[model samples]
Target: MKIKKILVDSLQEAIDITKSTYGDKATIMSTKIVKAKKWLFFSTNKLEVTIGIADSEDFQKEFSKEKELYSEIENIKSTLKDVVEVVKSTKQEQKTPPPITQVQPQNNEDFSLRAMNLATKLINAGVDQDIARKILEDSCGFDITIGRLDLKYEDDYQSLIEGLSKNISLKAINFSKNILSILALVGPTGVGKTTTIAKLAYMYKSQGFRTGVITLDSYRTGAVQQLQSYVSLLEMPLRVADTPTRLRECVGELSSLDIIFIDTAGRSQYDSVRLKELKHYLENVPSLEIALTVSTTTDERIILDSARRFSELGISSIIFTKLDETLYPGCVLNACIKANLPVSFLTFGQKVPNDIELANYENLANILLRGLS
Candidate 1:
């Protein structure tokens, strides 16, 4: 096999380059956006794509044969070692009678060992050490006999993680049957609030719901234009509410629609004034659900801090974006657990609708344990 790293402007360009250089059989190992210095105090970002190509057919066959031969040799060595161990055990057993009490000591030792191992696995999987330790310690009084330990330990671990995840708060937009349901997305700058709103607009529109979008993000350049493009493509109503009164009026006008998603301007979490202003926009709005959109690519601490700060706006649910861009996707689990917020959606790429997925406990568990495909 051969591996190469190529820097390109986009993911598509990286794929094209990989295909051209390594043929269609090549596989992409990873893709990340990296910043490079072009000059002093000036930098540009590029996609760093790692790809691999398989060896030739003849070479693969030779490797397979050698692997099988090595496996057989290792198996013979293992069998011989097992036989010697058994012989020594038999001699010992004959020399001295077997211990009358084995189960209690063995069970206690196994219990401690398994608990430590489980905690280590969680930590290795990017769980916060405190969270992982607490989880294991909470289960200390549970039965850890060898029989129970052998009974689907992996499934138990997954269940344990899932249960902890469920403790996090998750709230979805409560769409009314007769009245329009209003959803407002609020988050820090560059967390993809606008893009996430577009994805949700597309999703609801495709479901045949009367969807409309209103943006309170006129502060950012091109924010309205970007959302306008999506609303135009989806053929849904678009409104720009630059002020709290305008937002209320816009909500009143779009109230007839089945779903109305309001996009708020991204403010720094540290900026309490701006955050309060953002909150003021929706404080008077009745029956509105606010979804806090955040990037999964950021540090777990940042994510938690963002959630805490944004909770001032009464975040109903969390929408994690850029899951595809992060190496430690387990941050999703950590963030959800730490913030005690339920996830509304997960967006992995730039594509609208297609890149977004509804959050589920099973799917999150799989990603936390196995990672993204």
Candidate 2:
């Protein structure tokens, strides 16, 4: 592990300095506030931070274990805090949930006649419960807490779809007006990022754009080869870039083309180190617009979290893939509502050019309606 101590005026400055020196994987070993008398009546407080970056895999493993231990400790503290809150509020607030007697059918025959309610449909369609209720209240003004709410789909379906697609933003892919447009796709592992890249490549190449491909995907096994196969089929030149300097060279080499598609390695959203490393490479490429590729099959919470984590690297838009894998792709709309990022393209199947389509207000809302309803 490499350890370094930096002095700065504020904590945020210390963080920036440490990140620039050691990437996002650096651990803060300690921090000290050093007070100094600058003049007879003046004094200044300087922040001293010690940061450590693991140099090897074993060191990183040990650092992870330590982080987990501290996380467990924090969780225990949080639980105790919650317990105290519960004890203090128990006597003042006695709001127990009502019984399940209402959901029970008077007879099994009545149960057979029952159907799913609006709330259940919203939830079963993979929309977050709170978000669905909020959207309903905002759009249709539906009171969800009134009894079983009768688990049945009704006229509110249009209102619910409107709520999901409300204020939704959609960004179009660059068509290369003057200078070459460099588009990159980034996301966590196994979200079909490379496949999506291939899809976009084919989409542009078919439009008669002079296209080129550059890959920062040397870390993944067979990643380069996979992209190579796609570019080969399209009869376009492919370049491999392993470092930031190499990426600049590749971009410059392909500047004469209409569009240069950069395929990046799939890194974990939780891995701050890899994300910052990817950001560093992107900073070298000018006019670079990146789309965060996410899968709709993942949980809504995870989808939102991935969006939050990757936003640090500066995402221009989002590309949702693997919509056919789940019946309840409402999570996509859920993320669109929460993440505040526009959708560029959505891929439904693995058929390269045939499965993807540009996202807009009508189609985005209609896709949710077609699947959820």
Off by over 4 Å in 1: 1-121, 133-166
| TM-score to true structure, per model | 0.64, 0.60
lDDT, candidate 2, at 326? 81
Residue-wise lDDT of candidate 2 within 1-373, one digit each (tens)? 7878888888888888878877767878899999865887899888888988777785778879999999999999999999999898995554654443334333223321122244456577677776656544433331235433232334555555555455466788767745689899999888988888788888888888888899998877888889988889999989999999999998888888888889889888889999999999998688789899998887767778889999988897989999888888767767877898888998899887688888865665566556733
Query: lDDT of each model, Cα atoms only?
Result: 0.76, 0.76
Q: How accurate is candidate 1 locally (lDDT)?
A: 0.76
Off by over 4 Å in 2: 1-121, 133-165
On a 0 to 1 TM-score scale, where does candidate 2 land against the true structure?
Answer: 0.60
The number of the candidate with the highest TM-score is 1
TM-score of candidate 1 versus the correct structure, residues matched by position: 0.64
